[model samples]
Target chain A: MTTADARESTPSSKAPRTERGRKTLRKLLDAAAIEFGEKGFHEASITGITRRAGTALGSFYTYFDSKDEIFRALVDDLSGKVREAARDALQSELPALETERAALAGFLSFAREHKEIYRIIDECEFVDPQSFRHHYETTARRIHERLEEGMNRGELREGLGEAHAWAIMGMNVFLGLRYAVWSEEAAPEEVAELANSILRDGIAPRSSNKG
Target chain B: MTTADARESTPSSKAPRTERGRKTLRKLLDAAAIEFGEKGFHEASITGITRRAGTALGSFYTYFDSKDEIFRALVDDLSGKVREAARDALQSELPALETERAALAGFLSFAREHKEIYRIIDECEFVDPQSFRHHYETTARRIHERLEEGMNRGELREGLGEAHAWAIMGMNVFLGLRYAVWSEEAAPEEVAELANSILRDGIAPRSSNKG
Candidate 1:
């Protein structure tokens, strides 16, 4: 199954049985994102989340066991959404370099719309260390897989590996933090193209031009 | 003055008068690193930091007025040390790419020795947002300066600028997080070389080898 389908089926014990139940679960996760994002984990309360969702307190326990559980679930939910955003941008076949550029552009747009994502994810380091690590690890792994595919297609260098993926992931993430979350001084397309140029030719002077 | 000298002169009101006082101040900052690193800003207490330093309450007051003050001071101290570490690695003049490699290697070694640096710096985002942003902005500015120097020296391609610096900083920081702080699976030199290769040639296959 695709990542979105997997996300839909995850946190299995609390999986919704009815369409109405799924809507409530979605509402809780969305509300948790805002509550936790604005107030952070320590200051964020389940009551606040429920109030934001306009759902009853009973509806909360019906979906999540506690605040921590929902927070963890929210992180997982967001991670999947990040994947989906990138996936949506890669719906058509494109050259490997263009693929990377599209993915970053998509991420920048998503981050701009969901500015709270940075705070929520960063707080996970203290609030939920395992989830924090998992998010980046999984994201890097996905990037590595894409790099491997690019290599197999003879579009990238032969030796690209986990380190290269980590490098690209870091570049995209920091760019989002600067351009998307911090300020939109430059357009996302411009940012993505600049990063893509680095991936294409690096900062080294071309030998042909040196002479 | 150099960054190190500036670091020494900072938070100056409570500056040490003698060698003994300097030792006491160092003790407090080091202890604060451990306290804030392990327990985080909220759970970390002034007494906890003082006890860890093996200093009395009077010494804590001598340097910092409260936990918040010490945390802010600690962030500044650590940011300065990060610069010093990179500066130390770059004591000798080398090519621009080599400079980048040495800086990454230095950072990885520093992170391994002081794993708490990551937690402490990350926490500053919430506890002291200004310091956190300042730390990254200054670091990026330094990198931008290096890139400009590289371009002027004819060692790097032209058009490299602030975005490129942020990209390189992100790459080094994430690589240190994965390889140094999380695990020492890869040697610092090896990781630095891998990143340097990307800076030099990127992940694109060389045209000569395309056949």
Candidate 2:
């Protein structure tokens, strides 16, 4: 198969036509995460992914054509999982600040469970620059949308725009890197509260209202 | 020379005892930054760095025994430069919030001027993980100290700690990535002001003081 055959492997494309096919595909991606995370992109091999997945070599070819294809696919898969994890935490009619807190808490938990996610996505920078940029840009856009919703509801300050969203995204990402991936000294709830408070009351002294 | 010889090359160690030696070392490091930033760690070669520095190959081996050693040194150099940029932006006795703004603005300007910095520092994660961790840990410690100073002076809130410092650092870094490195559509002062306002009043609406 040509390298272009890998394009059909993504869920958005051909995907797996049968339920069994879908299950096999899921196993393949999960195995790919471990393989790439442990060995990094250069050292990771397609055979390693299939072996970890407990699938035949033909099954691997039925989906991805090469290591690069599966790595890109895995990045997109993790990106979606990050969004889903956050979405699962939110309830309708929650306060703007509370929404952010829940999302971050959920994300931190997800990050801890899948610490390998960080290594894979970071490695994507060298393996697939386009996917790396797309993941962050898309994530930041989601954040910006939430900020706008809060503004329209009269919950947040006016003029909370793209830069504010990017700032908050940065805060969440770095907090995860330090607290979740690096170590577990701090609880996810505690770390989320710290970030949430920044959005709610900021770091200014309470009694001193200079304005 | 043995691999151990590279250990003496750090500025804290041998550090090129003479003025001419120091200048040559600086040129070598600056060239390494560009080479690593452009070609990345794996593709980047020691010869590539020396050629870019316009120095002889002997000079390369004089300071670093291998490409990995020079890459580690380069990460340290960039990390120090980040600290200096923020320090140069500050005037003694500035307000706590203003200090953060000045530091961020300085960082944004630095990122803009040395757009290669992000790639080089990021690649350090794969090439030299210890230096990568050290760079961030050191930066967060510096920011944490500043926050404590603010609290002591009654210029900021109480209970602001390492997590908060990490949050602010994340904001500055992502803002720099989006605005300074990726695009220059927004001014550094403008981005700094936006982040400053978040620290000052947060995104909560003005009329809603339910707490």
- Top candidate when judged by DockQ against the true structure: 2
Docking class of 1: medium
lDDT of 2 by residue, B28-84 (tens): 999998999899989999989999999999998888888988988888778878888
Worst 10 residues of 1 chain B by lDDT: B1-10
DockQ comparisons of all candidates to the true complex: 0.63, 0.63
Worst lDDT run of 10 residues, candidate 2 chain B, spans B1-10
Expressed as tens digits, the lDDT of each residue in B115-177 for candidate 1 is 999999998889989888988998999999999999999999989988888889999989989
Q: Backbone clashes in each candidate structure, one number apiece?
A: 0, 0
- Per-prediction TM-score: 0.95, 0.94
**Tens digits of lDDT, candidate 2, A1-211:** 1123223337455578799998999999999999999999999999999999999999998888788989988988888889888988885668788889999999999999999998898888889998888888988988899999989898898999999999999999999999999999999999999988888888889765335
Candidate 2: deviation at residue A138, Å?
0.6
